[model samples]
Target: MIFMHIFSSLCVRTLTNRAHAIGDELAALFLLANVCLMVMPAAVRADETTGTARIELLHLWRTPGEQAALHVFRDALSDPSMAWFDTPVQGGATGVRKQLSDLLAAEAQPNIIQWIPSEELNQLFDLGVFRTVDTVDEDFADKLLPEIREVAETDGVLRVLPVGIHTYDFMAYNRQLFERLGIELPTSWESYLALGPLLAESGVPLLSVSDENWQLTAMYRTLMISEFSKEEVLSMARGEADLETYRNRFETTFEILFELRRFAAPDREDLRWEETVARVERGEALSILLGDYIVAAFDDPDKLICARSPQSSYIPWGFDSFVFTHVDDPVLLQGQTRFAKAASDIDNIVNYVMHKGGLPVISGVTPDQLDRCNADTLVAWQKRPLLWEGLLQGKNRIMAMNAVIVTIWRDETITPAQAAERVIDAMSRP
Candidate 1:
């Protein structure tokens, strides 16, 4: 049966690139027969085996260090007591999406796969394709941070597990530049905005930003928090909040953004995250709003400095996690649970997050372990209420409004009020 399956798969592969010919119908019949004879029997046997559960993982980042950590994860699963089956596939962003589509179409979908922030997981949950871990293990829910749990839960059911938390829209500045200018670190939006004219006078560009819309989205989300509470932000996400409230805050934010735009470089729109970071590192730009993952770009710690965007104080920091999809086999479920626990173990979790230059969601790391982190950046992750206040109060919203207003200001498209109105318009969009 296995031989027939291999033979049929080969014929299918060959026919895949060929145009339909006279023998096409016969070839199709042969392929169909082989699939029934070979694939079905193997699937039945796999179900009967019962002891080992198979899982496939898809991940976005395929850096060398991440690949190494996956190797460790694979080795951990190989333990005799584990009763696990696992495969790891690494790909670029586009590849990950394609692979996910293929998995959803498989005859027997994997018991586990990587999940992103999208409607796809919700769709899968609605299809009953994923098992609810929250139902099976109450302890799992208890182990998560409240914010992490909140993000993982969809409609009162847990759909994913958070692995770590990172603030991608936080701002970073060159310590040397601030020192040279004799300017103190700006703590409030008022103080941050005040730098615009000073930068203009010095002929130094004050801000550098990327061209990516998602980065803009991250910046906007951070800004939204300044205008709304955590609950309000979630409400907005659920389509329950008033768009006008969000728009009003965005208007205030755009005014500041337009002012900052005067100090940006001429070719700023052509720059990307890496290029902006390079500018900051080279002292060409004084500050940038970037994700915490920027630590991954710099090899020498001395050349760079980082701080949480004053705006990030509005949201709790959290990371993406792997959630096991639902499976019918009880043994497989058990194995998956065990694997999840092992994955969350402090030793492994801390090492993994630290290596990636992000904060661990799980709480077991020692102070010494944290001290070993190469970068000396201040992480602005705080508890819930303050986080919400920062977001809803207009502090963070300015950052997003600033991104667009600044661009317009640079292009001479409109006055600050008009730029602010544009930001309000953008935020008001669905």
Candidate 2:
């Protein structure tokens, strides 16, 4: 009886040990499964990493010198820590509207593309296509020029990162011609008009305007700045003011544009901005009302002299910046944030723009970098107020300013007052 009792006890003990062992094995398997599920995707992404990025760039075929500025960006991305996974796929300049349409259609778009104006940015944001970069390093914003920093943001959100700072409404001159002709630089619209006949008499076109309507439009905005306060302009654009008020301003600016046209080259209707700049460079035209980017457009930097527009009190006419679309992809969003932060860094901004013969938007560039540029020209840009003068302002009235100028220049059928009326009509379009 005693032996039987001991055997029963041993059997019970064995069954308990077996049950505990099974539970241990099951727990181990569950933990392993959880880790595999959690970590596999990240491992896969890691393996797929190709150190080089494939980026598609869309920009106008400007001067070869301007095109070559991409090297500075490419080199900046070569740092190991930044780990850019892009390789540039260069494409010819398509119209801004067309490019946005195609970007929406592509299954996988380029990681980065040059941004269009602010109006287009609004449309892009509505589509939920762009990724917002929130993890930008604190120092990034500090590197940008105050104007660039202001323009880089929209509704308090930082959109595009500016690759360079540009002042679009400034004028360029042939120093030798101005000196030979013994003409002092014009200081105001009135002064400029005073010299127009003298310039025409010397057989040099007073201004070389491109047939491209945008250039003519830019001139109108510069003139508007002189005539109206910034608040008045913004209010008019937002439809807070009546057409009569806007028309009055528009007509005033148009009248000046018309008067300036008399001194423009006869073939101006056929000339593009590049050709116009080239004519000025060759001394066929005494001056051109263009932006600082003209310095990059010239093959020999020494041949050009850039200054704030003598006619507009030296206020800058336009600013270029980057905007991100509302993107949902975590990986892409991370990458863009990193890129934006690096690009906006003060040192990088200075390096990129200065190398391209552009002014640094960020302050504190070393003397060595500034030494490479035309010192006086850089100083002039530093003192100017950057303007955002493109059709991107989303004001129909403002856009018409360009159309009116182009139509008048081309057909020679409309008086300046009539052109101003047409501009008011266009701006009033729903």
Which candidate number has the best TM-score?
2
Given candidate 2, what's the lDDT at residue 398?
A: 60
lDDT of 2 by residue, 1-430 (tens): 5755554444334434443444323223223323322222221232333433322344443566665665566576665444443332223222433343333332234456565345455444444445444556756666666766665656656666676656655677877788888878777778877877887777888887776766766666666767776556767766777877666666777777777887887776656666778888888888887666666666665665555665454444344444454334455555566566556666666666655555666666544566334355566655654445443355665655555667766666677678777777777777
The model with the greatest lDDT is 2
Q: Which stretches of candidate 2 lie over 4 Å from their true place?
A: 1-52, 78-94, 116-123, 134-136, 150-158, 246-249, 311-318, 322-342, 355-358, 365-392
Q: Give the TM-score of candidate 2.
A: 0.73
Candidate 1's clash total is 21
Task: Tell me the lDDT of model 1 at 250.
Answer: 55
- 316-412: candidate 1 lDDT, tens digit per residue: 3435567675455665566667667566565666666655566666543444565332223222343334332222222333334444633554456
Q: Each candidate: how many clashes?
A: 21, 17
**Scored by CA lDDT, what does every candidate get?**
0.55, 0.58
